[model samples]
Target: MTLKPLADRVVVKMVESEETTKSGIVLPGSAKEKPQMAEVIAVGPGTVVDGKEVKMEVKVGDKVIISKYAGTEVKFDGQEYTILKQSDILAIVE
Candidate 1:
């Protein structure tokens, strides 16, 4: 199954990030704050809202940083994904 976003929404999957200490001990990703980094899975086409055009800045395969508390989480095909609006995406990671 695939998630296709609509109306300026975006679907993304969280990218696991790990931290390493100076001693070479790697800490698990679960121990950190809410994961804000994710990979763009699907993108919605630009839409018109309230007489304004809302364009999507992120595209599929793009790495982005989203708001910690934004979006809805969905589990599909045993994988987790977040569906959020384009405005919730803070920045795109180059």
Candidate 2:
């Protein structure tokens, strides 16, 4: 099965967070913070809302930073994904 987002929405998979700090200390899972970065898996076509056209800036395979608490989490076929509006995406990582 595949995930296809609707207008103005995007689907992404979270990038794994680092398990060790700069000092080479291995942190436990309980001490790790959720990663803000993700890789774009799918993008929705532009949408029209309130008489304005909202174009999607991100595309598949683009790495980006998402809002701290944005998007809904989904589990499919043993993999996890997040579906959110384009607006919820903060910046693209080059």
Candidate 3:
């Protein structure tokens, strides 16, 4: 399925967290944490600021790191998606 983000909205698919610990330890399914990183799937044209349309700095396919507590949770077609404003985006991965 394809989706188009509208004005000031961005679509991100969360990156999966590792199931195993770095210290050569394994974690149970219940002990794992949700990954805070994601790749940008889609973004709105731009945000309106002071009656002007300001183009966004990020684009599709950019790996991004966002705040762990940002954005609104949403679901579509059995898949989870997060809708966030440009301000909520913390950094763009190189």
Q: Which candidate is the best by lDDT?
A: 1
Tens-digit lDDT track of model 2 for 15-78: 8765767999988655778888899999999799999999888989999999988999999899
lDDT of 2: 0.92
Between candidates 2 and 3, the one scoring higher on lDDT is 2
Cand. 1 TM to true fold: 0.89
Tens-place lDDT digits, model 3, residues 29-86: 4566667788888898887889988778888898888888788777989988888887
Model 1 agreement with the true structure over 7-94: per-residue lDDT tens digits = 9999999999998999999989988888889999999887898999998888899999999979999999999899999999999999
**What global local distance difference test value does model 3 have?**
0.81
Residue 81 in candidate 3, Cα distance off native in Å: 0.8
Order of candidate numbers by lDDT, starting with the best: 1, 2, 3
Lowest-sum lDDT 10-residue window in model 3: 26-35
Candidate 3: clashing pairs of residues: none
What overall lDDT, based on C-alpha atoms, would model 1 receive against the true structure? 0.92
RMSD of each: 1.7, 1.9, 2.6
